[model samples]
Target: MTDPDRERPAEADDEQPVDAEAFYEALDARGRPVVTAAEVAAALDRPAGVVDDALSGLESDGDVGRLDVRAAKTAWYAPGRADADERITVFEKRRDVIVDQPAQYTRALLTQFAHLENTNREGGYVYTVREEDVWNAPYATFPELVSTVRSALGGRYEAIEEWIEGQWERAHKFRLATHEDGYVVLEAKSADLLGNVAEPRLDDGVLRARMGDETAWVAEDRTAELKRTLYEAGYPVQDDRELETGDDLPFDLDLDLRPYQADWIARFADSGSGVLVGPPGSGKTVAALGVMADVEGETLVLVPSRELAGQWHEEILERTTLSPEQVGEYHGGAKEIRPVTIATYRIAGMDRHRSLFDSRKWGLIVFDEVHHIPSPVHRRSASLQTKHRLGLTATPVRETEDQEEIYTLVGPPIGTDWEALFEAGYVAEPEVEIRCLPWASPAHREEYAASDGHGRRQAAATNPAKIREISAILHENRGSKAIVFVEYIDQGDAIAEALSVPFISGETPHARRSRLFDRFRRGAVDTIVVSRVGDEGIDLPDAEVAIAASGLGGSRRQGAQRAGRTMRPVGKARMYVLATRGTEEEDFARNRTKHLAARGVRVRETEPVAVVDPEDASATPDGGGVGFEAER
Candidate 1:
């Protein structure tokens, strides 16, 4: 049998004579000794078969060597020019491929390169360093190899250090520790150094240098934020912050709950910490009590005011198995600390008494009107240790950026279905009327124009025309329960005196305020004027009407709270806001009503009605009224 690869054919006489030596010399002149059969044929102006025959003849004569460059392709090279088995070099080899000076590599620079490679995982390049030959890893190209080596030797050793530090970070454990000065420090275990492990902003001198072997420090109050960041970055964290636990005082409570209230309680039980947002009079207190019952341990309740604290105390006694002996009040002159304690934010946040509560263990801590918890003074309560935390509020928003702090401290907020509750008749359907009263008294208008921003606003908010409107509203709703919300104590007093009704303010004695609230609840007093103290966290379930004579400047929280004061379903409850037309009061009223307007409550406007001037007539203030024409 003949070998097909070795077969050769006879060349015709018309074909030009093949010059193997000249062909090899021409291929060498082109800077490559290897010549394919097709190139030989083209250079000789002959067919490929003819060139193949000549190459076979030359190979038989042992003057030229054949090499298989690839499948079905042959190359003729001088015997010593190249080797067939050698691997191709994609880049040039240089003596400086390995960096000599280690200090030239920086962690940040290496991290930059590593991040580039890491971000493109499918690029077939390895940027991570290994323990062996980690610094001298192979490069994909000659230029890149030269550039990387030169950078490593050019006083940038931190690059290599950063890569190694990342490796250490992935395997180490981190923890938090509080310093005596109230600052927090981060410490690491099994870490040789803390090179670029955390953000540079946290690298104060105290922890940066000493982090050489198994310890690092940050001198900021944002330890919680830092912990989250580090944990997300693939660092193992062992949280060391102290958490206090109260005595397990279990109890059973017998009470009926609405479906949504029970659902919120179940959610609280699962998470152990969260904010419950519901409309006013939606039984947030009942849900909180249900959480307390489920927790079955010592509970501490925080409120925004003394009145709210008293309300919480009363609710705990009325609704829970815990008696008055188990509950205690921590506001004002009383500093009792029982299994179930109710304290105002002012009392709980007091530096002198903060330690008393901070040191004790609490199973549950309930924050009423939790929106106030974002304030700097009130935020201190966030650090208190409790197994379960519940924040209850009718209005969970604030007009400030501190609103985010509430979520960070407590947990994510879960809100009740306001529309669902309203449809189910669990809450009132508000009929809001915006009475655009004309600014009364030329003296008042002149004073308002002459005053600065604050004084001007006060003048418009307290215009005598608003008093006339309030009087009309009171008379329109006569013989029914009503609460008038005033911005100032003097304004509440004036309204109460003119209408011959009771009034309450911050300075009103606790006993007298309680009695007044009771009288208003019953039919003894048809109306009562209260200051901003009644805007939030006070239960006035039976009042069918709320009159807003004055309010804070453009505060949605104040507006929502005031509207919520009459949110108890009582046969189409009404909220009457009296604002002077074309003044700052109108602007403020618009700002306040925006939140309510979003919830499908239209503020119907009413033209001012003419009435007998109280100063000139002997007519009763409640009866000398104006009729309203609802205008959307």
Candidate 2:
């Protein structure tokens, strides 16, 4: 049976003709020649109307690509590369063919992509495109390719079937050669294509598609109904099964589950969908897996970073009985499909060129670092029709303009309070001590005030004199293994240079960073001056002290995460924040206090500052814990 979607319309008598050879020759002649209608007519030795009509027809057929020319009636045509790419052609053929035979292809793509997204929020799946493939070539030639195809078919071919069977044979061959690299290309037309191929079944007013051996569920076509129901229902808890730990297992995974993690699973099981906002070391990852285990669908995890993807891969390996084959990692650099997949945000979101929509139907999508969903690409993931969506983040709130989009698109926050988590012992609580640094010399103060917010914070945080005081305090009081965190990379470099300690940043390579983290973990490195790398994901449990030199104003999540580095319940933890007195630094420090308070972390100001011992001590300002010796 010829599906209506696969049917080509009858050729129009007034439709344009294809000048395939002429178009190809014209594209090949110039080193970036701007072809105007007059130029095309001259080249083809045809009338201007013929040239214009032919070019328009080619553009419509996706053979020739058209770009607008400013203040001109003529549109420029480039080759449409997708038309020539065998991978796309084959996909087009197979997509339609499979609908008639094995309808599961559509379902498989949707399911898998959806599941992978659920895994982590910030990471992207890489579909490895071999350098040898023609499809991976530059985007400039795509319009030209399309134009060539259209011109070759000419105006005589009016029906889609006739074009596909006759003149499009070459195009079909290109599609056959180009493979998906395990990453599915989700186009705007894909949803409609799927709807047409698989007869949609109406179940309890919900939309269901049955394709070959598989049946998949889609969000009901309620238009405004779902939102209305949600508003009226007020987040009713659905009956879902919670998985018991160590009760049923397909594989032997090594890891201890905290009771709070069990409760996280239970909550997800109870409510079905919500965001898991926790501070660092709160074990959000493990809890997410448990939720996946409890849910009926295969788990799809998405993360923000490649390192996090690797981390999840290692953890998933430990937990699932699925072999390496079953667990696929779809990132930007590599593209292979798997039943249970782990991917990055770049793969699922903005990296649309790779066409991620080709994956299977996702039962659940886990967004690690939920705050990222506010990003333009990530926000779109929330609107995707998935069975369950879980967003995981250490700090979920960022004052981005797209917060409303996040709420509507990615499910609303489940209301997991950071303080509540600490009180419940899901996360550890730390004692926060505020240290006031003395005003810098007049010259230094002028320089600081002259700089931007970031610079001012740095000048205050890394004053050479303050480092020595911190050194003394660390030697006398904090852990042997301590992390001195600064807001700026330069400040980190300065402190590390001064203290003769190692440090890492976003620019740090994976191996070197891993080695540094290991050394810190093993206590081989006593003090590490890390910038923002310490904020999320990396586990530094043994460290008992966190010295925050500078940070955001009223960023409760940042404060909680920084403090949580030492609050791992291994022992009593102390978080010392050095704030320069009588500046925005003081105000920024105070503003963040409220959010941290939610985590049950209170910052107590120590009284009566002690000056560095020396002849200068008598004259020096008594800056409490804040006054540290210079970077010496």
Candidate 3:
């Protein structure tokens, strides 16, 4: 049986006959060194279609090379004369090729040979021959290449020089625009080959131009200073978006706001967004709540931790007229959205939650511990549309430069004077003491020297001498409520065991932690040992003393937060920091206390204390007890 789909034998018409040498000679004899297929057909006395087919065959066989000029013009030259390694070519149009030739080859060739410059006067086009298009051309020195380019572009187009200068200027310019959604957009223009600039920088070196398909888009909230910076840099800016405004809605709360708290709410009402920096237990939360009540619409509160979220939920229900049914918790498994939603920063930044909040306009957004919002992960939540924003934090200064970003994102800072509060007897005045202690035992010193950076810090923080000093400080303040801060969980546990007090860490269950906190609040517990989890937004107004036994190295923010834990209105509070003298720990201690010192808190140095050598189990010259001099 014969199959119609079976392959058939080749016929005479299937393969067109083309004389390879004749085509080559014909191309070589052309008046113009490079000619199109039509010109080659005319010179060869052959049909244009036949000539085009022949040229394709020649290209595939490596006998000729093809150059795509402007529009539909395809120029052909001898393969050896137009090979990639021998010349540099620049394209006037953007195109994609399957296999890209190496750019270094062109650069090297340009360095050795004079570049070939082609100009299409009629088409208003000018470009140099690309390295990939160079097959076989004479190579010259780099100076010769420069001279060739200069000679080619000398007088034909004086506008080319102006265009080059214009490109340089464009690459450095940035413009500010407002997106339809009200976020600031920074667009960067550059003379990139494809006219696409990615991640460009402005003149100030701080603002970055984000890249888009055609232009760079900056999606940060812009301040007046940023606008002025762009204008000074000679870039046009467009900012037509209206500032957010909130209605002075009617509401009532039985709680009396402090004078400072009332001033913060009033300022926030005028601006519609701002950061309120106040000491812990200084009624910052109360001020934020007052704003929420006055805004009188859907409210979204973002907190740093789940515990804080729970705290906010409790406070809202107790202090406001809003009913429990109107409030919701958008955290973990409970993904409820209501008129008043309290969510942790982590959960609220999730796509599902962000979309839900962004789908509608919120009346007010309260960012607790707003300093955390400058981080990239938390900053995404700032994109939510809201009429009013209130940022509440004990520490407005961040460890990183992103502090500036926070100022722009939330608003300018309106801070309460901690020193003024202390002087006026509105907040507790702290007596700071820096107690220098001797190094640990000989064995411990050797271990510290032999360990890595992290291990050495741990050894310094957990020194036996420091621990003894902490014990002494605790004994001295036996009747006062105290909080001992430790960097590590094991340290907190050890200190808690030694002091016979309750300990709290991130691992503590909610109910147990709450009970422990309640016990401390009721004066049932004289001292509580806590890890870094208690550093921020935890109200411990009754704590009259703080002993910082361990901490992160040289973190001013951490130091400030720990000091703020005891800054309630009361008699003078005592803060004791135990550091090993003549070690890196001493340097870190100085750095840690710098923030406090800047705020006019006097640091008094106490005489050094010496301890017995634990390795030899030997007693000191004055017996087995540690000795300390009175404050100097």
Q: Which candidate has the top score in lDDT?
A: 1
For candidate 1, the per-residue lDDT at 279 reads 78
Badly placed stretches (over 4 Å) of model 3 are 1-250, 608-616, 619-632
Pick the TM-score winner. Answer: 1
Candidate 2 global TM-score = 0.56
Model 2's alpha-carbon lDDT is 0.52
Candidates' TM-scores? Answer: 0.62, 0.56, 0.61
Q: Which model, 1 or 3, shows the larger lDDT?
A: 1
Per-residue lDDT over 1-632 for candidate 3, one digit per residue giving the tens place of the 0 to 100 score: 89743655434223545566766666566533345576677776666787888888888988776764211135566754433322222332321111122222122222221222221212111224332212111111233323333322221233433343343343235545557776565555444511332223233433445446444444354334454444334332333334354333345665888776787787676656678876676778888888887777678899877667777788877887777888888887477787888888888788866778777567888999898887878988876777667788766566684464554566556655465456446678677777777665666666677888889898878776665677677667778889988888877777777667788998898779878877887888888988888887566777889888888484677877888777888676888877766568776776676555544455566754434454555533212344443321
Query: Which portions of model 1 show Cα errors greater than 4 Å?
Result: 1-198, 201-244, 552-554, 609-632
Ordered by lDDT, highest first, the candidates read 1, 3, 2
Candidate 1, residue 412: lDDT: 46
lDDT over C-alpha atoms for residue 285 of model 3: 84
State the lDDT of candidate 2 residue by residue for 30-114, as single tens digits: 3232345555665655566777778888778776766441112243556543222112112232212111111111112211111
lDDT of each: 0.64, 0.52, 0.61
